[model samples]
Target: MIGAGSTVIFHFDIKLSDGSAAESTRVHNKPAKLQMGDGSLSPAFEAELSGMQAGDKKTFTLEPQDAYGMPNPDNIYYVDRSKFSLDAPAQVGMIIGFAMPDGSELPGLVREVVGDSVTIDFNHPLAGQTLTFNVEIVQVIN
Candidate 1:
């Protein structure tokens, strides 16, 4: 059974509330593996997968809070347009990578560009939306 401390290999399809596909692992013929109770998954997500065995298929819906959580207004920031490269001008709906203090890149979506101010939203693209997950468990190591 899949429970705490179990390692699970599964393929999943995620869809938005409008029934639009968001992401799927099977598209690439690759399954995902994760350890139960790992920080990679939220507690609510873990609860949904508890007590299942290999070969079990399940579909579940998660509200915003249980999934990516609601977007925070504070995550929006304004940056100077000059910060963007000429090759990739700041355009609305463009996802840009900003260098972090830790030397890693953080992705931010461009929301608006007016004069020299470019508005960027740092929230996850699916943050405020409910999502449905279709999962097929291929293997489980307890």
Candidate 2:
């Protein structure tokens, strides 16, 4: 059984609330490994994975807040078109990385591009959405 110290490997298929596929490790024929008691996954995710054994299959759903949290208004920003480099023009649906004051890069998607302004959304692409996870436990090592 999977417990706090167990290392479990599993294959997962993720779907959005709209019934569209988000991701699936089965397509790559690779199983994901996770060590319990570590902070690799969210608390809710860990809770859901606990107490399962190898070869077990389950489908669970996570709410927006429990999954990626709700979208923050502060994450949306509008920048002038001139802020982008001429060689790298900003276009709608583009994912661009902007350097922060701490020298770390934050990725933002171009939501809209007007004549002189570009609206970028820093919220995670999955934010504010319900998620379904279909998981198959392949192995467990204590």
Candidate 3:
């Protein structure tokens, strides 16, 4: 059986609130190994995995706050249309990666395009919605 601080290997499928698959470790055939209660996952998300034995399969849902937190309106920003290259076409639902001041890339979705401005939402697409995860514990490695 798995307990807190145990290192375990597992495969999981994450689905969006709309029932769309967001990611799956099984697709790549790679099982993930992690220590329980090790800050590798959100507290709420990890709580569901506690006290499970190897070969156990479970499915659970997590609310936004417990997953990625709610989307904030302040994350929406408008950029001048001219900032984009004239050859680059802007469209709704397009994900644009922006370089932060720290040199890290942050992805933002194009929400709308106006005459001279483009609205971008920096919030995570999964924000403000519940997520479902289908997980199978493949092995318990101490």
Residues 24-125 of candidate 3: C-alpha lDDT, one tens digit per residue: 998989988899888867888788888887999999999998887899999999999889997887789999999999999999999999898999999988
- Estimate, for each residue in 1-142, the C-alpha lDDT of model 1 and write its tens digit: 9899999999999999999999999999899999998788878888888998889999999999999889999999999999988998999999989899999999999999999999999999989999999999999999
- Predicted candidate 3, C-alpha RMSD: 2.4
Error of 1 at 97 (Å): 1.6
Q: What is the lDDT of residue 54 in candidate 2?
A: 93
Ranking, lDDT, top scorer first? 1, 2, 3
Q: Best lDDT goes to which candidate?
A: 1
**Candidate 1 wrong stretches, greater than 4 Å:** none
In the range 11-104, model 2's lDDT, one tens digit per residue, is 9998999889998999989999989879777778878889999989999999988787899999999999999999999999999999999999
TM-score of each: 0.93, 0.82, 0.80
* Local distance difference test values of all predictions, in order: 0.94, 0.92, 0.90
Candidate 2 has what TM-score?
A: 0.82
Task: Please give the clash total of every predicted structure, in order.
Answer: 0, 0, 0
Higher-ranked by TM-score: 1 or 2: 1
Winner on lDDT (1 vs 2): 1
With candidate 3 superimposed using the best TM-score fit, by how many Å does residue 100's alpha carbon deviate from the native? 2.2
Error of 1 at 45 (Å): 1.2
